[model samples]
Target: MSSPAPFSRYEFMIAWRYLRARRAEGGVSVMTWISLIGIALGVMALIATLAVRAGFRAEFVDTILGANAHTTVYMAPQRVENEFTDDVYVVPGRIQDYDAMAAKLAELPGVERTTPIVRGQVMATANDSSNVAEIFGVSLDALKAMPRIVDPQTSQGSVEDFDKGVAIGAGIQRELNLNIGDKIKLIAPEGAKTPVGTTPRVKSYEVVYVFSAGRYDIDRTRIYMPLAEAQDYFNRENVADEIEVFVTDPEKVDDWTLPLLEAAGDGAQVWNWRDASGSFLSALDMEDDVMFVILSVLVLIASMNITSGLIMLVKNKGGDIGILRTMGLTEGAVLRVFFLCGAFTGIIGTIAGVILGVLLALNVDGIMAALNALTNGGAWQPEVRGIYRLPAELRAWDIFRAIGLSLALSFIVTIFPARRAARMNPVEALRYE
Candidate 1:
């Protein structure tokens, strides 16, 4: 063809012609198509699984960090026995001069917000349903500072409304059948000891609003009330159990730990969110990695299809290969022709699969909702399993890794079969015909 332009154009043209040929022309069209489909399906499954895992971990981390703090300063626990009874208990040392402590914490670099919290175990009863809960007593100013604790649309009631009421979590509301403005009883077991024995302190509070932190445990067990009221109920005054410090960069919490403790002065011990939830996060990460490896096996299986197709293709084209070899086509060129056939399937299939996967990842939530609808009430309800929808997040690196692996496998699997076709003795190949 006018002395072939170079870069193995002659081989490429032959490969293209072979791809377009009919089965009656000794072309392995059916096997080629099957191999392409297998590759595509394998790639799609990998992308979807990885994206879903990434999204799940992201949402869970956000929910947990939003409800808690990046770092918390708690005093050392002090054990003390009741002077009048046999009750010996360990009470956490409270932060003194909390206003100064919060101010000091806010001055630290990377600190976003600081709030004092009073936490204690309590039992909540409403509509004849009782559940043990953790109570968080926060100042109104502090509550407003934390964006996750309040919903402006729902918490737009008068100051008087919140003065005597409390905010419960969505899970708590569902568990107790509670509604806004409804009354609930809070029973604190750590009350004063009396002549009649250690008695529990009880108080009535109205539900002002419900906050959903997107975490089941926080929503189920946490309730927030005015700092003054909680202090009154918990029998603590001018003191807080800890100072919660929010940072601008939570990923660098480890770096911020020592500096924050030093800034808060001696006797202040600092711990980051990771310290409390590290194992849980690590488990999720490990599961995500395991899923990637597991799904990659699918691609490996698909690559076998490429090998099979190329071998069949080589077998069917023996006569044509002999003719090319007689016409002075080098063994390398012959190898390239077959390699292109297999490579084309892998590259095209991977690209198509990536595009389809990205589209699915972007709209996975909607897809889950639609699926649940089709399945009817209990069939595919994510809520029944404790999540609203299946989350999906596709990262560029993850996509690249998947595509690279597929193409690499495709290229590698083509080598042996292509070499075999290249080495076919011209006389042997044509002698049968």
Candidate 2:
């Protein structure tokens, strides 16, 4: 007769019979249940952690890129020599002919759009409230195109009146108690120049728009004004402080540094978002690695239950194994049967974990909202976390990794008990009975 194929139907049937046996009859049913639950919980926890990490990182980076420039080109500082005193002084550079330069930079590879910005710090006061604001001078067209500023989900008011007034962050509006069409006074410390000295420039503009960038700091402190108004307010005429460059891909910004510099020409310096936010991104990456290591240990611990369960099953079935071996069962068949029992538990557990994790990830926002409501809106603080909401993004690779790790551990731990069952002496096992 031909030898039976590996892992035949009989092996699976025997494994199922052993798994279903009653605990009172020397069965390991309780241990099997415990092992399955443990593995499932561990896998679920790992998947959830990974999803949160990914979502947090993505949201953080998205806010950064959307609300700010991917890269900025500024005029390099120039050294000026005093002819009479024979002394040298460094003067802050200004980007004159910025329109032409912005147009040139927009043509470079991977360059999305370029906007000339006049930036300044000023005190905003309205309705007996005052706050410091970092103002960016941008064209109405650019303001409308900006991702965070024009986002319908978070922004209120209209940019049509932007040229006639100013757009303020939601935080600033709340602090100053200002609303659309309300006048807000901006006090610039370095203002008009007179014969005697300079005076602080104080001007009032109507709040034409309000926006939320989904970031606490940005939404709290940023303001957008018309380019002409900002230029006049900041005493910059026919010049720009810097050119903000958006790119096709913010992550590959470094690759465009040289090209941007070349396009910007001499007396220009380049700075990218990475230069400003690299340390924070690195910290996030470190946190992700640490979390994965910690959760992997949890999975390993849970898989230990599988080893214990399989060992008990091996002991309880010793008599059955001796009879089967005497009848005609091969040692390999005995090992396969026991291995199938543990593998089946792991497979089912991993599938259940994946389902649970995906469901949780998909509903994370609703769950967080419910939790926050239960805690009286204390569960999530945007100011503390720097994000408006808790985010959870389920990635296919993360789920696959969780499944792989759990199954690998289960198989490894099951080996020892399986080998022990296969090598048992039929005569000795029968003698004990």
**What are the lDDT scores of the predictions, listed in order?**
0.82, 0.90
Model 1, 292-336: lDDT tens per residue? 888788888888888888888888889999999999887878888
TM-score of model 1 (CA atoms): 0.92
For model 2, state the Cα shift of residue 356 in Å.
Answer: 0.8
Candidate 1: Cα lDDT at 84: 94
For model 1, where is the 10-residue window of minimal lDDT? 151-160
Q: Model 2 over residues 344-371: C-alpha lDDT tens digits?
A: 8888888887888788888888999999
